[model samples]
Target: MKNVSLGLALFTLVACSPVSQKNKGKKYFADLLKDVDKIQLKFFNHGDTLAESITDQTEIDIYKELITGKRDPKQKIKCDSTGEILFLSKKDVILHAWFSSRATGSKYDKACVTYSVEPESYGSALTVRSGQDIDDYYYKLRSTANRMAQH
Candidate 1:
């Protein structure tokens, strides 16, 4: 009787544990797609000076479209590997992107990607940087901001 009871108890503990099996199928960068549901853009001058920002729904939608459209759904996250900071979030969760000024073969460049997600908090808080796709997001943002400025 004791043997049966202990086995049942162990089984119950395994089933009731807080650890989740829900993430078994998840892949890296899976969180990024969900994280970008609502992103805002802001530009800085000289790396610290305020220059331009994008917050309106129209612009935000356009920016999201431009960014997500850059990659195929199956391979999008791979772009994050080599990017230089194409999608960045800063200053109250504002997203910014910048392209590298250095040549492709250079060993390193000042502009590079950094990624972080907050831990020991209520939920995941993600931060990202771009790699090779910097120009794709950066120029689009700059062009859109400039056009709005013209109007």
Candidate 2:
């Protein structure tokens, strides 16, 4: 009788254990997707001065402010030729993109802008194209990138 009771207790304990589905690639931004339409992308252009002002450290500062709404004066980010900022979530979701000069004769030549966000689960890429008017697609990409970076 004692052995049967022990076996039953052990089985109950094992059966009641909580299973973890947090392996990897679990959707973190599931809720954020629904509110994507509400995002706004504000464009700022200081021409070459703005572009040149964005050093490694400054770029990180701007990125942090844009993404997390927190500014760290000391966090140094090494900027490359592309002037891109990359922020990765603990769960491995990537907010990877770059902004560059859109040539000399373009409408918005020296404006800094992000191009896209590539998620690990989704195979198709999301891109924000250059346009004269600020559109919903650009805002959605920007907001998604910001949320992903914060995560």
Candidate 3:
């Protein structure tokens, strides 16, 4: 019967489609942090200048945990960046984390950070707002950078 044939064809098409394969699970921003030995935290002074890189493993680990631990998925993608953390392995930058400034909060501000695998290609990457537990880390880093810049 045509009905049976059509049903079989549809089933085959659905099973072989790329969407079906890609839908195994949702990929989060934290997925890109794997195997990164050194994470360089570069604080931005109002998007004008970048402070010195923080390479200490202890500090880097703290930031890594704070950033990847909790995430509030954000639908809105755009934000004013205040700082970024580069996830590196063997001296090669693997991922870039662009975080919003505390001073530039809007009505919808929930403390967001965008993670990009490629440089300057955040439009297709994952952007997540921080949960209550990890919200102030961005501001804290910026303050630390400001103090460093003064010296």
Model 1: runs farther than 4 Å from truth?
A: 1-28, 38-41, 47-111, 119-133, 136-151
Query: How does candidate 1 fare on TM-score?
Result: 0.29
TM-score of each: 0.29, 0.22, 0.49
Residue-wise C-alpha lDDT for candidate 3, range 37-74, written one tens digit per residue = 78665555546454445466655555455444232346
* CA error at residue 25 for candidate 3, angstroms: 5.6
lDDT of 1 by residue, 66-129 (tens): 3321222342231122222233234344333332223222234343322333221111111132
Report the number of the highest-TM-score candidate: 3
| Ranked candidates, highest TM-score first | 3, 1, 2
lDDT of 2: 0.34
lDDT of 2 at 15: 71
Q: Please give the lDDT score at residue 84 for candidate 3.
A: 65
Query: Each model's C-alpha lDDT?
Result: 0.36, 0.34, 0.53
